[model samples]
Target: MPSVHFAPIFQRHLPVQSLEPQGRDLSECLYALFQTYPSLKHYLLDDQNRIRQHVAVFINNQALKSRTNWNIPLNDNDQIYIMQALSGG
Candidate 1:
């Protein structure tokens, strides 16, 4: 089982908590997360199912390269973190 964690900022819109879901990759993990919290789907992805510009996903500290290919394999102990991409002037 892999663990999924959302940044503190997301607590404003939904419950702030961590989840351990069974997923071979990011896509499966997200699907399971959305199933548990449907509202998150809109916040995380756009109409094309692409990751929202302001959002970033990292698997074990490595950012995902392809939004379309969420099939990036994961280990049983892997940790996935989701957070807002920061921008500054």
Candidate 2:
């Protein structure tokens, strides 16, 4: 199974630590993430089942165009990343 690891941006809140999820695909991996932090869906996915504007998902250093698209497929060693877009002054 592949592992999805969250970045340190999550440390903005000390109580919530980083997450590592195991699954074979994007959906399953995200499901594992949701299981760990149920409230995370509201921050990432929207009502239409799409990733929110501020949310970003990447696999092998490439951005995902759709949450339910074919581009998100994962393999045994895939490393998925989920993060919010970074903005600076």
Candidate 3:
């Protein structure tokens, strides 16, 4: 299982602040999370099933480079972080 942590902004609206999702890749892990919190899907992904433009996902403290590619493999000890991206001056 991989540990997934959500930023405080997201956590405030969700039931959990973190989770240990069961999956081999990012997509599967997100799917498992959506199963538990269906509403989260709308906040994290767009209509195309891609990560929302304002959202950011980091794996093992490294930011994900491809928002459309959710197949990134995960290790049992991996740490996944999801948050709202900050922008503007």
Candidate 4:
């Protein structure tokens, strides 16, 4: 099963712990998380079921390119990190 971790900022709103869930893709994996943390569903995704603009998702240190369609493949030992995106001029 792949593991999902939230950044410290997000942890303030919920438990700051690692999550292990079963899924073949990123969306399904995150959906599993949503099942556990219902509030997180709104924080991470928009009404369209797409990743929010202020959020960033990384798979093994590489940031995901597709925000709307999270079909990235996952491995049993993969690590997924969800964090708030930092932006500046």
Candidate 5:
């Protein structure tokens, strides 16, 4: 299982701060998470099923490079992080 973590901003709206999801890839993990927390899907993804513009995703501390592809493979010990991107000057 890969450990998934939500940023503090997101945590405020979630039941748990972290979870270990059984999935082979990022997409699967996110799907599992949505199954557990249906409301989260709206926060993370848009109507087109794409990542929300204000959200960021990371795997093993590295920012996800492809917003269109969520099929990135996950390892048993992988750490996935979902955060609300900060912006403003």
Candidate 6:
């Protein structure tokens, strides 16, 4: 199973979690993680089940280019990390 870790930057907005072993694939694993931590569903993804704008997810050090709909494949022992994007004016 692959491990997907979410950042605490969205904790206040939603009391979810940080690290979780999310089986495989992005959608399925993410959905499972959210099922364990429901509050994360709304914060990490929008009503249409798409990734939020201020969030950045990387699979094995590669940025998710698919944006709203990602197409990255996963295998056992893979690591996925999610972080909140930083912006400065």
Candidate 1: where are CA atoms >4 Å away? none
For candidate 1, what's the RMSD? 1.3
The best candidate in terms of lDDT: 3
lDDT of 1 at 28: 89
Stretches of candidate 5 off by over 4 Å are: none
At residue 2, candidate 2 shows an lDDT of 68
**Can you write out model 5's per-residue Cα lDDT over 1-89, one digit (the tens) per residue?**
89999988877468788999879999999999899888899889999899988999999989998777999999999999999998999
Per-residue CA lDDT of model 3 for 10-52, tens digit only, reads: 8645878899989999999999999988889999999999899
Positional deviation of 9 in candidate 6, in angstroms? 2.0
lDDT of 6 by residue, 2-89 (tens): 8777687866644555566555578778878777778777777877778888888888898888766655668987888888978789
Quote the RMSD, in angstroms, for model 2. Answer: 3.0
Indicate the worst ten consecutive residues by lDDT in candidate 5. 7-16
Q: If scored against the real structure, what TM-score would every candidate get? A: 0.91, 0.74, 0.94, 0.91, 0.93, 0.80
In the range 1-89, model 4's lDDT, one tens digit per residue, is: 89988888888556866788779989889888889789999998899888999999999999999888788889999999989999999
Query: How does candidate 2 fare on TM-score?
Result: 0.74
Ranking by TM-score: 3, 5, 4, 1, 6, 2
| C-alpha local distance difference test of each model | 0.86, 0.69, 0.92, 0.88, 0.90, 0.76
lDDT string for model 2 (1-89, tens) is: 66565666755432344355676668777777777776776677889767787778888788887765633567877766778877679
Q: Local error of candidate 3 at 44, Å? A: 0.4
Residue 66 error, candidate 5, Å: 1.7
Residue-level error in angstroms, candidate 3, position 64: 0.8
lDDT of 1 by residue, 1-89 (tens): 89888898888656866789778877888998889888899999999999998999998999988777788888989999999999989
Query: Which runs in model 4 stand beyond 4 Å of their true positions?
Result: none
Error of 1 at 74 (Å): 1.0
Instruction: Give the worst 10-residue stretch by lDDT in candidate 3.
Output: 8-17
lDDT agreement of model 5 with the native: 0.90
User: At residue 45, what lDDT does model 3 achieve?
Assistant: 90
**Alpha carbon lDDT at 57, candidate 4:** 91
- True-structure lDDT of candidate 6: 0.76
- Give the C-alpha miss distance for residue 9 in model 4, angstroms: 1.3
